[model samples]
Target chain A: MSEEKKRKKILEVKDLDITFETTAGNVHAIRGVNIDLYQGETVAIVGESGSGKSVTMRAAMGILAKNAVVNKGEIIYRYCDNIGGIDYNPEYDENAVWKEADILKMDKKWIRKHINGRRIAMVFQDPMTSLDPTMTIGKQIMEGMIWHYKIDKQDAYNRAVGLLKEVGIEDAEKRMKQYPHQLSGGMRQRVVIAIALSCNPDLLICDEPTTALDVNIQAKILELIKKVQKERDIAVIYITHDLGVVAKVADYVNVMYAGKIVEVGNINEIFYDPRHPYTWGLLSAMPDLGTDDERLYTIPGSPPNLLHEKEGDAFAPRNAYALEIDDKLDPPMFEITDTHSAATWLLDPRAPKVEMPKELKLRIERMKKEAQANGSEL
Target chain B: MAANYNAEPLLEVKGLKQYFTVSKTFMVKAVDDVSFKVYPGETYGLVGESGSGKSTIGRSIIRLYDPTAGTITFNGMDISGKMSRQTQKDLRVMMQMVFQDPMASLNPRKKIKDIIGEALDIHNVCKSAAERDEKVEAILTKVGLAKEHADRYPHQFSGGQRQRVGIARALILNPKLIIADECISALDVSIQAQVVNLMKDIQEELGTAYLFIAHDLSMVKYISDRIGVLHLGHLLETGTTDEIFNNPVHPYTKSLLSAIPIPNPELEKNRIALNYDYKTSGIDYTKGTEHLIDGTHYVKCTDEEYAKWTK
Candidate 1:
């Protein structure tokens, strides 16, 4: 089904490595990571805190901290340089091509003027912190357009009200004049989404956008994002640790563990037929509504310390089915299908085959049965 | 299991009301005429949204914020208002609380030993310094921490470890009831499970009752024997875990249950969210009353709606 849709690669990251120089020691925040984001699709990065999910997205957006260092990587973003009547359709003719810039190599001024908030936008976790309390909501929403596109004040103002209405905010004109504190938590988030969407960016990076909202409000926000994505054909990268949220929104899933993507697959593959042990632990650890078990199946140990250099697989100590190779060497990404891969020694053909835990298997079966009863596809 | 009818509840809250004066003209009814009972060796989960006043009810029960009206009966003694010094001191040892934020709850300047030991010292539970140290060490170990951790500051520990310290301080009092207010909301999934398992184990070992206050429905269903659904500072529904989850009668309860995001992708896709509108529903809570549906299920509704709902 995914192959049938024509997808344009909007962003690509190859071998991205990030480190932080802390007083205690240097923290290896991001390992040799890679990701491919296409147009009009949602990809979720799931992990616990300190798993470097936020750091990776921050590096992509050129918003890393001062103490952070990009050891080696290339973040290539593709955008059509419409000036001077340049041909943009490269697929039809070899001469027609778009401009590509490596974000890491580009100067800060160039990126800020051309790329950041123009072709890509970010929505932070806390709307209160992201939205300026001093400025009116309308002015904050219009600031991006006026600065980036050099639009007139009246045009920006008209579009800002439209954007607020599009985000499902009632009384858009009245709310535009209100400050951030005057709005409720859900309304503040809606305003944040409106500001992020004002620029009409190609990709919207939402970093735990709904973590601060209540469940009903969270559902509304997720639905709003999905609706906006469909209407505008914008690719979304959601960084969150909640599996339930991931299952609802994502088409693809990346399970990160200790600064590395341990597994990458479609949502169905990750939830129903998970290959990595850490993914299994995450799924089992969540207490579902129907779960009646005495105790949740935890991942045994806490996340590994990133201050020290990691040896072999970072999750080897916590993996219950770890093989001898997991302790000696880091495992390569073993392909399960064209769209699914897992970094685990157990995926090696020479290693003995092991099944997922019985509890998880039973749960998957129950989920499948429930889905069938509801006439939904898994 | 059925509730013990003859035995007195460990904690009984009757017509509890906590109001805050937001302005000179307006008073915010944080907890408005709510009532529940926490039996000995049972977990009573209180689930609601952020402004629904679940935390306010907890604070009122623990007397952190004195209630504006109604009585709180602990071990058959009415300890609501204007208690004697000895009664207040005795009530302190019988009831304790675990706050939500571990970092903010624990004093950064004090060592874990002193933080937990202060409770013992205030209550004069220990005879000497050695006995206090021994008790602190024992409680720390009981919460899955090493005795050596007692010497470290709160900043040195992780989020889960700091929550363990909070639990240790609450357990050191050897209270009959502990009100855990969103204690596991800040931790990760794996660590949350560990902490929850620890709570269950402690409850089993000590047979202590708990007023588990949180917004997460699945966790509440897992830990609670009976649950009370609160909305706008009112107790809308109260029932056993099974009765509340499987046979929700109140429209508010149904809406809350439907809003919970289950983990299964396919199931969640098929899930239809029920939005409850109080304005359009035309339900006046002031005139509404609690209606018993079954043996252990109760729903708040008007007389006409109660007949329809029960029917």
Candidate 2:
């Protein structure tokens, strides 16, 4: 990765904590989540259900459920209108962000005006919920630009068409005129993408955008996101449980387990040299087409109850390779490589040496074969 | 692992066609001319995307949805056409279904005892209310739920527990076959495996066949003996689970199999993104002889294309 290509930090989240006040108990959804978003880089937050990957991003976007409360975190955002071919560079002023506003502390009403959609846009998991069923795709796409940027109707329409084309939606004019219901699942997603990019927001947060889509449609949507990210050079936060999706589009990966990031590294490091046991369990459970394993492995037990306050490593009970120290004390993320870090006892010098699963070793061999076949570096 | 050709089929669907009348003139061919068989104690997997009528087939076989045409033979008895009241009662006791949403499938107002007991009551299995309660408790215990849980509501239980309740409800009838329509798709992955294992264990103990319908081909391969792929209201292909995945024939099946997001990062990056061309259409089913079919596999394509495949 070149330094020049190394994008400036567009958004920075620090020590984020969120809890949902439910009748059963307070559910600690996210804890001490720290993440950085560089301009034009796609950072994928991957995890299983209730792993708080979605909640973490939801907190950043100020869309957490009403029962939820953000106890700590500062989502520092720096926006430039130069994203969509507009030359509105403010000379990259460092103090400009603090001077302009505080997203975490600011009133949501104010945030909606200056921050939401205008500077930072989001595409949620289900397009049916995010998109208006009553309105035409064209109107919905143009509505954001008209409301936020005060852009003219024709220009907004043109921009919407451009976005539709950019997302690989053919016959933009016809697709725009059609209603959301008329479009297929894949097409509807593309329309949502168009709507998200209507204002040319600097940061695009896609929360499981392809989960509802079929596999074929999912591939197209992933490609569309990558295409848009590269073209617009906008920072992206891809939140999903599907690791395959993350691998295709994400430059970096964050593995979330029980409301905390168990591992964070570049895609290669996270996949090939994953240090966390939880990450290893996840990797091992996935069914390989090439593998001859009769039984598909599973991570034993369920995720920890969010209502119950966790004592040490949240994944310790489920992790087969968990050390005694893991249950007694929370392991800090040890630095493995410069770009790699994992929260696991395996990285601890004092911890007992445990080998990876035999299934994983076999999978690694297949992966190497596939890499060789594709003529690509693993 | 080819399907055991000589073995006696436990459940055979012949010329199954489920078409819903849209208004008066038009009919939505949700499931058109589909047929398949599940041998005794075999796990037959039905795999398809949404709108492929996978769930409809499961529902139809279990008598939850009446087929517009076709005959369903269970244990060599045809039960597809309009059934007599007594026959319907017997069918209800013989076959059961587990829906995708455990929350929705279970009755909200009814207690767990009443929910599981209803089937026994319908069948007149118990002589008295006390006997019914005892039976329900035994079934509850069999599915890994405590007998005390019989007093609780559906909302009181977690998703996995509720699914277990659904399983218990289906199993209490001692049905010959259970249609689990994406039953575990709504569950967490780890919980999904547990539920799957429980289903397998129950199958071994009770000798009940299963029509496991799901979108997850990988999981289907894990549980199913034979697999059938459905696409756009047509049965594209059918084969043994290993043969289906390892040596897929239909382009759609191959594409669908490849589309599954394998968790391996290296494989994922190299996965060929599927692109289908639905526009270059084939098939004139409207102009065809419009006769019912006896085969499990049906392909909606041009006659030439069909003939080529047959060759």
Best by TM-score: 1
What lDDT tens digits, residue by residue, belong to model 1 across residues A1-378? Answer: 277878888899899999999999999989988889988889999999999999998888887899999999999998765442211233455554577888888878888877778778998889999999999999999999899777789999999999999999989999989999999998999999998888778889999999888787788888889889988888999999999998888989999999989999988999999999999999989888876787777889889899987678999888889887787799989999998999998889898989999999999999889888888765
Candidate 1 chain A lowest-lDDT run of ten: A82-91
TM-score of each: 0.96, 0.91
Per-prediction backbone clash count = 0, 0
The candidate maximizing lDDT is: 1
DockQ of 2: 0.47
Interface RMSD per candidate: 1.4, 2.2
Cα RMSD for candidate 1?
2.4
RMSD (Cα, Å) of candidate 2? 3.5
